[model samples]
Target: MQNTPPRSRIEIDRLRKIFLAEGREVVAVDDASFRIDDGEFVALLGPSGCGKSTILNMVATLIAPNGGAIRVDDAPVVPGRPIAQVGYVFQKDTLFPWRTVEGNIGYALELAGVPTGERKTRVAEAIHQAGLDGFDRFYPASLSGGMRQRVSLMRTLIARPEILLMDEPFGALDTHTKLDMHSVLLSLWERERQTVLFVTHDLGEALTLADRIILMSARPGRVKADFKVDFPRPRDAVKLRETPQYAELFSKVWHSLGEEFAKGRSA
Candidate 1:
């Protein structure tokens, strides 16, 4: 019998991106390489303008890279052709002001031509999962920032994408709300087990959610370090911070990350 070769859910090799700003070329990412296996949650950590979001945009096929290659399931990522298996959540909630929570969450299903009955059922389940049951009829304008983001998250999750790309999804929330959002995300991830590439500059957020942390250097981003987060599964995002182990690892990773921050400041 022939053995099957190992395949990664997402593979990036020598990925480079350059942006033209004011008629000058600025390198965003250079020689970046990484692989995310099925169901792994990885965090891309770096200071602002480190090309973290740029990488996610490239993976989602929102933009073409200036050099190198990105592969999903061993297939090259082509510009203008979005991978159906991927979903993205941006920094903002981006909810439609006119749409109620239920309507927003079910929008994707409707777009896919799912029957109204089926869409309602799925939307109800997603609303429940996101803890927005009673608020289903409420518009995004009325919901709190955290609540709005929950709707945005469920909106993408309802599509059941195999890969999730989140770009600072909770960055706008206050500390308390951010922690709450963290718990919600952790619960959803535990249940769904989607391969996630989360981009954030917040170390605690990364440490709380990721199975591994891929630290990127300042401008002209490159892989600075790959740190495995050995914290056990089904993590309580809030309680994890109190553990001595969490603090130790935080210190270690922060040391490396802090250096990049300093470099970014100097530049």
Candidate 2:
């Protein structure tokens, strides 16, 4: 008997999306294609308004693609009801103001109909994983910005997703906090080897976290360049930037992204 190959974690082929603005058709993404291997971390890095988030939404099935296909584990993605095997952490905290940290993290579990007994166990584990153990009973307003984002992470992790999609999750935090969160995210990613497709305009974040970075052009986005990060795994996000290799890659990616920024400014 022949053994079957492991299915790709994500396959986006000829993916496209268009929007109607002021009665004018605007192409958000034009023929973006890429593949992500199981357990790999990939970053979609591009200029602002380059459709990085649009493509992410398309892959998440929160929005339908105007054309082409997206598959997760070889299964077709259904629009608006994407694959449940995925978790999403957004650019801003989405915690409910009325709910305690415990309540917030358990919301998804509650919706999934997980037994209360099991949910308690899972929620506790997620809280500990996110360093929110003592803050479990606290409300969202009380936690610092970084702490709130941790709640968002724990909230998603409680679902036990195999794939995680992050769109500029730390973009609003202070530089120090952002770096800390990078460490936290990397540690969690190392534990499970979960497939991640992160969308960010931050080159440093992409270089520190991803196995590959896909660059996209300005509006009416298309794949501009795809570069393998080639950094060693189990990396230390705080120290990763100090390496000679990191500097070299930074120069290369900045050059590509710089051109896109110029195009956006001129248009």
Candidate 3:
């Protein structure tokens, strides 16, 4: 039997989020709506604490929206349902201490009922895909921070989820390592073409990897500006950073967000 490919990977319709503060109401996301086609790379750009992760969380089904709805392949995202369609790599690595790299990567598949006999091959492939080929036997405690993150990414990729919800996956790495990871990730994405929703505060990172940039407003985020990245694929991050158009695009988004920041709405 053959499985059918997903039609649309993610659809966020009129998504709204609100939080109760000490004594006031906080709207984390205000009527936000967007769509990501299967195999598309989209970046959700916003300031810190700007509800970027909130939106990502909503899509990941980690948190339910106060208003509106999110669906993956026409199926509504049921709250707390294990999020099988989504492979989330959070800002930090959440690998288990007792698990080896291979074990960590195979965990999700195990939960999904993948036979133990098939786990090793899939885990090995995921390790290679994540550029952690020789580190499979290493414990999480034995690896560097960036390496730990690789393990996390490999774990997520091994599951072959329809959509990847990445919240600042590279935000914690050093500049050089982050650039390297960016290249590695772009290559993987180009090869697999999984629908991806990436949240980031770095304009350069977003521009380097995203097919489309969704510039979001400050806390209680809204889509302030949308830019279509005109750069050709297999983008060279270093070269793209030096291009005048790249600077121009970043400037535009900066100003758009600056307006919101200047108004004291940013967090």
lDDT of each: 0.95, 0.92, 0.86
- Of 2 and 3, which scores higher on TM-score? 2
Which segments of model 1 are wrong by more than 4 Å? 1-6
TM-score of each candidate structure, all chains considered together: 0.97, 0.96, 0.91
Candidate 2, residue 148: the lDDT equals 95
User: Can you write out model 3's per-residue Cα lDDT over 60-137, one digit (the tens) per residue?
Assistant: 778888999898888898877756667898999999999999989899899888987788788888888887888889
Best by TM-score: 1
Give the lDDT of residue 69 in candidate 1: 94
- Candidate 2: tens digits of C-alpha lDDT, residues 157-230: 77889999999999999989998899989989899888999999899999999999999999889999999999
lDDT of 1 by residue, 1-267 (tens): 998765599999999999999999999999999999999999999999999999999998999999899999889999889789999999998888889999999999989999999999999999999899899999988999999999999999999999999999999999999999999999999998999999999999999999999999999999999999999989998889999999999999999999999999999
Where does candidate 2 clash, by residue pair?
A: none
Better candidate number, 1 or 2, judged by lDDT: 1
How many residue pairs clash in model 1? 0
